[model samples]
Target: MRVQALIFDVFGTCVDWRRSVAREVAKVLPQVDALAFATAWRAEYDPAMARIRGGERGYVALDDLHRENLQRVAAEFSVSAPERLAHAWERLDPWPDVVAGLTALKARHVIAPCSNGSIALMTRLAKHAALPWDCILGAEIAQDYKPKPQVYLASCAALRLATDQVMMVAAHNDDLFAARYAGLKTAFVARPTEHGPHQTTDLGPESDWDVIASDFHDLATQLTP
Candidate 1:
């Protein structure tokens, strides 16, 4: 496919955001259902970004959106939201295969995150998860969010690669759809439990993606030279 770079959807595809955030939520809001709380907070994510994507608001970093959502969820749960809790997004843990898989991919092609996360958030999360990233590219670079053509195209531009020369690796069919529409290659990595044990969405590939793998380890074997 002439792929020179692999851009990833970081939150669920690389890291287990639901569990990682729930762990932190449990520590801070012990009285509430942490998993439920984490899920609730995350549920606010797309709607919040939609404001910007739809031009109802100017662009802001994902950190700000996270903080805003945390406040609302905390109030809904009748707990005082700790200011520091906003930083929890920066402390996500990667899936078990992520580190080794990304390391292998890095050996051959450039690897970076094409996430909705701001560069600062992505950088800190990379450090926390020990992800081997070649660079950070995504919403911050395009001043927009994912599912938007600009976000995917800008990420490829940042790497100085043509759309076809880059592959967007994501677990979500919608994400891959957007990336493909932007002219980049697509890879679907099944993260069946990204939303936890009973996760219903993105359990498998929904299209004829360029590559499909069971996990990052499998993805590395398929994509890495």
Candidate 2:
């Protein structure tokens, strides 16, 4: 089926989460260990998401998750953060190719983010990074996260397209697999640095995704008009 729309996974897919968080934290506490702080903060993401998924905790927005993790990491590292520092997650910097690549793709098809981020969080990040999404879709609406078929299908339903008519683009293989299971086309855009120096998985595509690219721009190039 011809792809009518492109849905993106944010965080490490379009934005450099580690680098962006480090940069922002560095601004607030120049002497703080920025890289370590970023990693420590991100370390809590999966466990927190799991808590919600397992019914151990109720649904919490990504922003809240980040803030909660940030506080815990800050105490662990003895880093004193300013009031504005907690908003670092909302101010992530987009990958260099994001704007240009999305601009090129958006010219031909509807583009949006189908992410684990909450609507408010995604909207703020889009405004901060100038992401050219025609719309923003998040798991908050479904009370779930990526790797869940409902999240992918919800995005397609919102766009009024069949599952096969929309494509899911992400840096993670699990995300692509979930989208494929949900009947959407899948694209893998590798983000080798997503998990920083300790990164082990997702260094490259783990599955035979419909399309694989070095980045969004390359994905845009390979996509059919």
Candidate 3:
């Protein structure tokens, strides 16, 4: 069946999370290595989610998890994490191509973020970055994290779409791998510097994803052409 919806991975795919977080850190903690602190804080993200995904913990919003992770990273740096710092995730700037590219795609396909971010987080991030989303869906809807079939399946169900009629667009190959395995079509957009200039992973498509595009603009053309 033809794909009717295009759901995206928001963080590194649509916004520059590393640089954005680093910028926020610099503003709050001028004494520390902001980039390193941002990197370390982000490093705590997956492990925290893994505990939930592994059934070691119950479902929790990512906003709470970010708060917990912030405390941990702050302790490592011997500084108290300011309450406002946790909100940094909500204020990330989008890539230059994102607004226009998504606007183009939104004209033809249902566009929303199927991100790991909680609804509140994604909602604020969307407003802050001016992302044009038809609706919000993802882990919060499924009460689980991605690479899990439930997240992908739940998003499709929420849209009243069959799995095959939805396409998962992400810069991370592993996310696309899981979405495809869960029966969604997949698109890979490279965010080579998501981790930083020295980033070595996901610099290119690792699998033969249904679509591979250089950016969201290229993706819009490829899908709508």
- Candidate with top TM-score is 3
Q: Mind sharing the TM-score for model 1?
A: 0.98
Arranged by lDDT with the best first, the candidates are 3, 1, 2
Question: What is the C-alpha lDDT profile of model 2 across 109-221, one tens digit per residue?
Answer: 99999988999888999999999889988588778877778889889988889999999999989889889999999999988878877789999999899999988789889
Error of 2 at 206 (Å): 0.9
Ranking, TM-score, top scorer first: 3, 1, 2
Candidate 3: stretches off by over 4 Å: none
Give per-residue CA lDDT, model 1, range 63-167, as digits (tens): 999999999999999999898999999999999999999999999899999999999999999999999899999999999999999999999998988999999
Give the lDDT of residue 101 in candidate 1. 97
Q: Say which prediction, candidate 1 or candidate 3, comes out ahead on lDDT.
A: 3
* Residue range 58-109, candidate 3, lDDT tens digits: 9999999999999999999998879789999999999999999999999999
Model 2 — which ten-residue stretch has the worst lDDT? 78-87
After TM-score superposition, what is the CA distance of residue 182 in candidate 1 from its true location, in Å? 0.3
In candidate 1, stretches whose alpha carbon ends up further than 4 angstroms from where it belongs are: none
TM-score of each: 0.98, 0.93, 0.99
RMSD value for candidate 3:
0.6
| Reference-based lDDT, each prediction | 0.94, 0.87, 0.95
